[model samples]
Target: MQLIGLWALIAATLGPFQNVLGWSISGALVQGYDPISKTISDLAADDSPVKWIQSSFFLAGSVLTLIAAFSAKSLALPGRVALFLAGISGFGYTYFPTALVAPSPNWHVIFATIAFVLFSAWPLLSMRFDKRYHWSLRPLAAISATLVMGATTLWFLLTWLEPGQPIVGLSERVIAVMQVLWLSFVIWSQWLHQKKGAPETAPELAYGAKN
Candidate 1:
């Protein structure tokens, strides 16, 4: 279990790292791609020259996230399910690559919105009041993570909805980074908790056993 947890941690960390790196590389490779003004989806749009590059990264990252979700046995079931759904949504949007001239509320947009909502809400969904759980899974920490991610998601949505929004890309990137960081943090906390030999559940005291 511990080894699997470690694997989960690695997957979680790599998912974010690869995504950010891929975004940077794809942006640089595609001439006229503007990281400050153009959304990452633009790099993977149907007409994008480097669509393959960005799409590949998005697929890989989503796969990694799914792997993490499956291997993270220490996480609450609700959270794990949310992560899995988010991963599925990621895969959905990647494969449905946004069309440069698509109509409003297309498949890509629908999947992306679902992914963002799940990613931002998973922490709160995973919260546990038991002392056996890691601090990151506690109510306070979970609530904080959700609030922060939710705020960023809202910021991105506002920018995305506005016509000719200059900061759409930046806001999207911010929310994406925040979601990844929080996921990685939760996974790492669980890994450390296991490493320290913490009990998964509080063991009941043996009848008449000494303190």
Candidate 2:
């Protein structure tokens, strides 16, 4: 869980900063290239400068995310499944790097959509009705996270479809940051709760008769 939270913070921090670094390193050739409007793939195109940063961000983040998903025993089964699919989509982003001047960009769109939806929905799906795990995933908090993420996604979609808006990059960044922060908070909250609630004695002596 700590690993997952740590990686989430690392990825979120790196995501935009890497793009800025790539932009500066690339001489910003793509005219009027709005970082928020243009996709991460733009920074990772074959002709783009500092392509490795974008590639590494997606590839490394995907690996860590997959590990986190598999090891996240605290999440419900559906949440884990959603995260696993999100990880797979993150891998797909690397496989289908979008080119600014490419004849077709649908592949990138498809993969990105998968990633966005899964990540957004995971919070809602992860809500626990049993109350035992409510410390990390209360119904109201999980629902709010899901709704906010979903709305952010809608804003991104609108920006993309409109093409005239200059907020694409900003919207994408917002989504990424929100999800990462949420994941970190959830994991940290769960870890703290577990630590506070744990028994001092060994489990072997839990139900013993005056042992």
Candidate 3:
């Protein structure tokens, strides 16, 4: 179980790493892709020349995230559920790539919204009050992380909703990076705690067993 948890944590960390790398490389490979104005999803749009690259990355990230969700026993159940749903959302949006000339209210947009909401809110859902857990999973720290992610997500939403918003892509990237970094921090912290001889079970579980 400990080995499985370790691999799960590593997989969770790699999800974000691959996503960031995916967009960076795909964006560069496209002849006229503009990160400032175009969102990451644009790279996987039906008409995108390098759609395969971005789509492949999205699929890989989602699968890795799902692995963590099911196998990272250090995380509270609620957090794991959130990660699972987020992974599902990732697959949804990736599989339903946006069409360059499609109308609004598409599946891609719906799934993307769900993904962002889950990502922004997962920290709060996963937090534990136990001091035995990592500081990042503490109530105060989790609340702060959630607030920061929520605020950035709100900024991205505003840019997305308002037509002709020049910073839409930039704002989206900012929030995405922020959320993933927080997740990575939490997972890595838990892995470190386990390495230092902390109990393998989640804090809540350990507390329950103690009682």
The weakest ten consecutive residues by lDDT in model 3 span: 1-10
Ranking by TM-score: 1, 3, 2
Instruction: Quantify all predictions' global Cα lDDT against the true fold.
Output: 0.84, 0.68, 0.82
Q: Write model 2 residue lDDT over 40-132, tens digit each, in one string.
A: 567767766657666776676566566657765577768878988988998887777776555465676788788888889988887775444
Q: Which residue pairs of candidate 2 clash?
A: 36-168, 36-169, 37-169
Candidate 1 lDDT trough over 10 residues, lowest sum: 200-209
Badly placed stretches (over 4 Å) of model 3 are 1-4, 198-211
lDDT per residue for candidate 1 within 53-95, as digits (tens), equals: 9999999878888987799877678988998999999999998
Better of 1 and 2 by TM-score: 1
Q: Model 2, which residues run further than 4 Å from truth? A: 1-36, 101-105, 198-211
Candidate 1 has what TM-score? Answer: 0.90
The lDDT, on a scale of 0 to 1, for candidate 1 is 0.84
Task: Give all TM-scores, in the order shown.
Answer: 0.90, 0.76, 0.88
Q: Deviation in angstroms for 2 in model 2?
A: 15
Q: What alpha-carbon RMSD in Å does predicted model 1 have with respect to the real structure?
A: 2.8
Choose 1 or 2, whichever is better by lDDT: 1
Question: Considering lDDT, which of the candidate structures 1 and 3 is the better prediction for this target?
Answer: 1
